[model samples]
Target: MAKISAFEDLEVWKEAVRIGVEIYRLADLSPLKHDYKSRDQIIGAAISISNNIAEGFEYNNNKVFIKYLHYAKGSAGEVRSQLAILVAAGRVNNEDYEKLKSDLSGLSSKIKSFINYLKAFNQKKK
Candidate 1:
């Protein structure tokens, strides 16, 4: 298989961006009008996931990149938690909530695994 050139080329990052788009769409349907707080928070967290990944990849330093990966994972968790709140408050249906939750979980795991892989790779080079 050919080598991947950047994190933008990574399937995980692509999936994370898709998840972000879905979150934005969901936020638009939320009944909490005049509450820009939660909506912006959720959208920001979702965007952070892919943004961090792209920023990390551009850094080219394993340690810095891993830090950004961790940030992305945290942002995923934030988005997941916010979605859970929306579900509990009856703002989002079970179907949408579950689907987004699962996607976020997968993105979190992928980011963590990528971080571990990079750490190991760098260690081997030292």
Candidate 2:
């Protein structure tokens, strides 16, 4: 495999960006748009997933990258939890809710796998 020099090259980062955009669009079209607190919180968490991944990768250390990946994974869970709240509050439709939730779930898994990979690599280096 080729070396990953930029965070943009990461599939998990791409997925996070897609989910972030979807959440933004969802908030714009759904009743969530009218809900300032929920809208902002959901958007923040969605955006954080990608941001953390990029931030960690920039550190250029496997340990640091792993830490950041965990942060990204946590943010994905936050987005999923907020999504559930939005759906329960009737702010988001069932279809969009399901799709975004599934996306976040997959993203979280990917981030976890990446973290494990980094941890193993780091261990081998020691």
Candidate 3:
């Protein structure tokens, strides 16, 4: 297995980057773009997802890392909620909202799995 030396090398973090970019592009193309408040809030939540992961990993402690992972997962939920709001407002189409929602949910599941794995690893080290 390849060793991870930085947050950028993390698969979850990488996936978040891809999703963030996609959300930004779609948001820009949608009517939501004109609503700076919603657009910025959604984008900020997207960024927070991966950012929490990176920040937690830097602390180099499994317990602290797990806490940050929860934060990241929470952010994913926030983004999904924002997406739903946009869809309801007709600022974003159902198709785009569904796709992004799936992506965020998948990411949240991965974060949960990662947290579980980390907890197991920590137990082993104890």
Candidate 4:
């Protein structure tokens, strides 16, 4: 197995980065113009997911890292909710909305699992 040294090595972080890129592209294609609140919100949430992961990893403290991971997971949920709103508002197509929603859900699960794994490891160290 490959040794993982940073959050960048995390599969969840990588998926979040991908989701952020897709959100940016979707926002650019949105027909609601610049005044669309959902555009910025979606992008912000998507970016937050990956940003928190990186920030938490840099902290080097398990507790701080886990807190940030929770933030990231929350961000993923935010993104998922925003996507649902966009779909309901007819701002995004069903296919695109579903894709983003599924990806966000997966990211959320991965972050939660990783957090649990970290907690377990920390417990063993105590």
Best by TM-score: 2
In model 3, which runs have C-alpha deviations exceeding 4 angstroms?
Answer: none
Instruction: For model 3, state the Cα shift of residue 8 in Å.
Output: 0.9
Candidate 2 residues 43-108, lDDT tens each? 998999999999999999888888889999999999999889889989999999899988899889
Candidate 4, 61-119: lDDT as tens digits: 98999999999999999988877887888888899989888888888888899999989
Model 4 spans > 4 angstroms off: 1-3
Whole-structure CA lDDT of model 2: 0.91
TM-score of each predicted structure versus truth = 0.91, 0.96, 0.95, 0.93
List the candidate numbers ranked by TM-score, top first.
2, 3, 4, 1
The global C-alpha lDDT for each of the candidates, from Candidate 1 onward, is 0.86, 0.91, 0.91, 0.87
For every candidate, C-alpha RMSD to the true structure in Å: 1.6, 0.9, 1.1, 1.5
What range of 10 consecutive residues in model 2 has the weakest lDDT sum? 113-122
Better of 1 and 3 by TM-score: 3
Name the regions of candidate 2 deviating beyond 4 angstroms: none
Worst 10 residues of 1 by lDDT: 26-35
Q: What alpha-carbon RMSD in Å does predicted model 1 have with respect to the real structure? A: 1.6
Give lDDT tens digits, candidate 1, residues 26-85.
887857434588888888889999999899888878899899999999999999898899
